[model samples]
Every structure is written in structure tokens, then in C-alpha cells.
Target: MIKFLSALIFSLLIPLSASAAEYSDGNGYTTIKTPVRTSDPNKIEVTEIFWYGCPHCYSLEPLVQAWKKDLPSDVDFKYLPAVFGRGWLAHAKAFYVADLLGMEDKIRADLFNAIHVERRNLNSEDALARFFADYGVNEDDFRKQYDSFAVNSRLSQADAKIRAYGARGVPGIIVNGKYLVSAESANGNENIFKVVDFLIEQERQK
Candidate 1:
């Protein structure tokens, strides 16, 4: 009786362990990380490679923001606007322009909303200039930097990184440049963060 009572108490006190299971459909589809990490172990970098026009990415912004806000002090988070096709280049340029202007954090969320909710077409130089003007950016200055060698180079690098990460779609998370977590693993934006936390813990031990 005492052994039985002790076993029951132990089971009640100990939480169930989580299994490392691969969640996927049968169509050669599986969740993968975004922004494939380069060999930079000085920091645990987490990057989300996304496009302004991607509905999945748009839906993920708030969840990613919350995860970033609560991130461990050692973790670094970055947003890389993915330019996977010709249609995405203009938005990528606009993202680089905002980065050059030091307005990335200030305008990133609005950019997402402008494309996803406001139904604004930011996929062109002219439209981007107009959008910036609304936000008080000098059109000439923005135009100068938008097509600058530096911005173009950065956009190219971002493209390469996205491809290297093997991301077939948006709303993906790459942890420490090795593990990827995406909505494909689970059905919700919050699940991505949960996978991120899991990956971080896994990396922490190594």
C-alpha cells in the first residue's frame, strides 16, 4: 500500500516528458528552418526570412514579435525580407531602404499591415516611394538609397541566404542557423515559437 501510494504521488508530481516527433504530411513535406545560420557561434541567431506579400508571414509577425520580446538575453533575432521571385524584389529593396534609413523597426510592422490588411501594393519602386512619402521619408533620398549598390548587394545576400536555408515558403524560423521550425510542423503561428523554444533548449545542451 505504501509503495502504491508513493508511486501515485511520484506520478502526480512529475510532469510527462515531451516526445521529439516529426509532424508532417505524406507529400514529401516537412517543416524546415528559415534564414539558415552561418557559422557564427558568438551569438545564437534566430532569423525569420519572409516576404511582405506572404499571408503566412503576415499572420506570423505578431507571434514572432512576442517570441522576440520574451527571448533569452543571449539570443539575437533578425528579419530578412525574402526575395524569392521578381515580384518580391521591390519589397526587398524597400526593406533595405528602411534599414539604411534606420527605420526598419519603426516601419516593419506597418509595412506588413500595409500589404496584408490595407491591401497596398508595395511591390514596385513608385508605390514604395509613395508609401515612404506618407511616412515622411524624403522621396529623393529614398530613391537614391533604394537603388544604391549597397542596398542591392544586401538584397542579393538575403536572397542567397533564403535559398541556402531551403525554405520553400514563408513563416519559418531558424534557430542558431541549424534547426528550422515552421507552420508545416503545426497548425498555428504559436507552434513555431514553441518549436523555437524546443530547438533553443536542444542547442543549449550542445
Candidate 2:
């Protein structure tokens, strides 16, 4: 159910067309008309909004991980699950649930591999519970947290941010809440960080 729904939403809404790699405004990156304020006014925030079921996102995951490894002390990095539909909403909720349980980092890579590599059907609650059980999280406890207020509240916040971003695709990168980058804008998945580095410096100089 979720798999089909998410794919439908993704295909219908996201424009995957590649743009010129001018490495400048409107080419490699786009300026958000209305900048969404960053969570921290002091640090430069780089947020990557993605979906687990997105192949492009999964491909870029390794690059994202490598890029963020040596982030400067003044820069803050975050990940927000993209919510395009109920299917996405379920994944978003699961993200927060994993965070709340202190298993986000541990489960992040495996979850992606489960869907993309292992080809597992993790589109349902029971499926996710079974997956979590491998990490020692009981099925009932996992479900309880999956439906908890904390996760839902985080989902609401993410949904609002997604709307604010006007994002039409996954593996979207937002720099300081002012500039947006994606494979479409950045020419390709590999060049995303190049444009992001430019934007980060651009913000730093301001």
C-alpha cells in the first residue's frame, strides 16, 4: 500500500529533469523566495530532506554521509524525512520514533538497505515492527512509540517544513534555510555537494 502510494506521489509531483550546471543561482542551486528561519540562529544549518524509498536518495546517501563527516564547528547538519503522502508520513513518523528510541543512527543505513538492497516489504506497521525487533526493540514497544505523541508532533513539524520548502523531489538539500539544491538543480547527484559547498560559503560570508 505505502510502496505504491509513495511511488505514485513521487512520480506525479517531483520534477526530475536535469538543469544546466552553471554552479550559480537558478542552475546548481535556487534561492528560496521566502527563507525559512533556521532552528539555530547562530550556526549555519544544512538540512537534507529525503525518502527511504527513493532510489536517488539512497544513491546520494553515501555522498551525504561523506560530506557531513567533516562539517565545521559553525555548521549544523540535520535530516528530515520527506512527507509527500501518508506513505511518506509513515516513514517520517518512523524516523522520529527511531530517534526517540535512540536508534536513529544505528537503523538509518540498514533501513535503506532493507528496502533498496534487501528488497524487503517494510511498508506496513507489522513489517517495521519485525525489522525493529532485530535491534532488540519489542514489537509492542515499537508500535507504542510509533504512535506516540512525540513522533506525531515531529511529523506535523516536518510536513509544515516540506510545504515551506516547495520541494518537489527527494535528496533535497537546504542550506541555511535560504538556498535549495537537488539533483535537478545541481546537474546530477554527484554535484549536489559542490553546489551545497558554494551555498555554505556564500552564507558564511554574509
Candidate 3:
């Protein structure tokens, strides 16, 4: 009888799933040491830092898109392209260019498809020009906006924020500039938003 009771208690103590796992600092997520500045002062901000070439980011993007639609009014969400080096810069530039032209929504998915699905080489100015042109942004227009002061500034700021957060991987999610949720921390991509939502509520209570 005691052996059966001990077994039952142990099973009950275990979390049902990764989603049901208790989220805490250094477990499901971590507190950003530097606590980077958020876009809004009055609202909770969730930033997903991603690299287009990342397979994990590709997997997580769909989940992110779906989860963001029903966010609370006080929550603000944005995507910050990760810039690890010159190799990652082109895609980051592509993100800001589409963002500057207000075409981010249109090209966001297709661009990811072109790379991950179609295996296209879109890491250069010429290739990006052609891709954007298909989406109605001409080469000259794409280049002009790609190198615009605003886009350049955003790129620089993104690099700084990721460094401040001490994120060593792509597809990183920063909540209210305080907590960071990654695949490893969340146990998998599927549970990232669960951890993110948990942090958002924690921030809300504060």
C-alpha cells in the first residue's frame, strides 16, 4: 500500500506536459540581466528576435503569428531580426526594408518560404532586389529603403538589444524586456508562447 501511494504521489508531482510545466527563472525562462528597453513605456512588450535562415525560427514563426493575433490590448508585440554577423545582415536588411515600405506582412512568409522551402539564395543585394520586385518593390526602391538611415538605425539597435539580453540563439523571445524564452528554456518551440504568456501575466501583475 505504501509503495503504491508513493508511486501515485510521484506521478502527481510530475508536470503533465511541457506546456503544463511550472515556469520559473532559470527553468522555463530566465530574467534578462541587463533588461533591455522596450518599445513602449506603458505597455508590456514581447519581442521575437529571429533569423530567417534559422530552421527553428521557421518552425516557430507560424506559432508566433497565430499566438499574436489575440494578444491583450495592453500587450505590444514586434519582430526584431537577429544580426549575428555579416552573413545574417542581408536577411536582417531585407526585414527592415520590407518594414520601412510597410510590406513586411506581404513578404514575411513568402520570403521565409523562398529560403527554407525553395532553397533560394537571397543573401545578396541583387537577389533581394529581384525578390522584392516581385512583391512590387522595385530594385531602386528596395535599395534606397534598404540603406535608409532609419532602417540602418533599427538594425544597429536590434544588434544591441540581443546582446543586452545575452541571447545566444535565434528565435529568442523577450517579454517586457525582463524575461527571455528560448527553445531550450521552454523545452521546445511549442511551449515558448506558453512561457511568454506566463511572463506577460507576471509583468501585468507588477
Candidate 4:
């Protein structure tokens, strides 16, 4: 009778253990040492490291936007374009130029479509100039900001932050400088924000 009672208790405990296993510390995300300093002390900074040329980053854009709409007021979302090596600095420049011209929101996803959907080679200054011209920005204006000291300063800052964040690839999500979540760690783009939400809550407690 004691053995029979023990078997029943073990079976009951099995389901509880399995359910608790869903949320794990290391399986879905990795913690970083020395949490990166956030610009706003009042808000939790969530940075999405991406490249405009990357299809995966393009695909995740809409989903991320939808998720952004419902984010808690304490969470701040920002983008940091990944500059892995040579040739990527051009798109990084495009990001800042759009910001300087106050057209970042208008051109961000459109640039992605131009690259992956429209199949345009926008990795060059001439091509980017033409692309910006279509949005009513003249070549001189676009080029001026593209090479301006302020824009270059922002690029340098992004480069340093990317290195310090230890980003491995495009579409990496860093939460409050403490956790790094990517498609590889989260299993797919769909779950990246879910892990991000988890990390936000984790930071809130600290």
C-alpha cells in the first residue's frame, strides 16, 4: 500500500514539474555581465540590433511594431543597426540620415522593401541619394547629413554599443543591457519578443 501511494504522488508531481519547466533561465536567453547603462533612468531600454538588408530583420519589423504598441510605459524601444563588417556602414549611414531629415519612420520599412522586396542595390551612396530624392530630399541635403560630423558621431556611438552588447548577428534584442535574445536562443523571430517581455519583467524586479 505504501508503494501504491508513492506511485500516485509521483504521478501528480510529474505534471507540475513539466509545467514549471517551460520557463527557464538559460534555455531561452542568456544573461550578460555588467548591465549596459540605459539612457533613461526611469525607463527600461530595449534595443533591437538589426540590419536593413537582412530579410529576417525585415520580417520581424511588423511584429515588433505591433508588440511595441502594447509595451508598458516604462519600456523604451530603440533600434541599433548592426554593422558587422565592411559594406554595412552604408545602411548604418542611411539610418541616421533618415533620422536627421525627420523621415526615419517613413523610410525605415520602405528601405527594407526596397532591398529585399524590390531587389534594389541600395548599398552605395549614389543609390541611396537617389532613393532619398524620391522622398523629396534633394541630393545635396541627403549627402550633407550622410557625411556630417553629427551623423558620424552617432554611428561611432552605435558601433561602440554594438561591440559592448556582444551582438552576434542581426535581429538581436537586448533588454536593459542584461539579457540577449536572438532567433537562435529564442527559437524563432516569433518568440523573440516573448523572451523580451520576460526580460523586461525580470529587470523590473531589480
Candidate 3 to truth, TM: 0.88
Residue-level error in angstroms, candidate 2, position 159: 0.7
The sequence of per-residue lDDT tens digits that candidate 2 reaches over residues 53-110 is 8899999999989998989998999999987755676677778889999989999999
lDDT of each: 0.76, 0.87, 0.89, 0.88
Candidate 1, overall lDDT?
0.76
Sort by lDDT, best first: 3, 4, 2, 1
How much is 17 displaced in model 2, in angstroms?
A: 28
Provide the lowest-lDDT 10-residue window in model 1: 22-31
Which regions of candidate 3 are displaced past 4 Å?
A: 1-21
Q: In model 2, what are the clashing residue pairs, if there are any? A: none
**Which consecutive 10 residues in model 2 have the weakest lDDT in total?**
13-22
| Model 2 bad stretches (over 4 Å) | 1-22
Task: Please give, for residues 18-114, the per-residue lDDT of candidate 1 as tens digits.
Answer: 2444333221123344435455676688888788888988888888877777878778888888876778888888888998888988888898889
Displacement of the residue 30 alpha carbon in candidate 3, Å: 1.0
Per-candidate clashes come to 2, 0, 0, 0
Which structure is stronger by TM-score: 1 or 3?
Answer: 3
The CA-based lDDT of model 4 is what? 0.88
TM-score preference between candidates 1 and 2, better one: 2
lDDT over C-alpha atoms for residue 94 of model 3 = 92
Model 2 per-residue lDDT at 140: 96
Better of 3 and 4 by lDDT: 3
Give the backbone clash total of model 2: 0
TM-score against truth, every candidate: 0.84, 0.87, 0.88, 0.89
Cα lDDT tens digits, model 4, 85-194, are 67788999999999888899999888999999999999999999999999999999889998999999999999888888877788889998778898889998899887
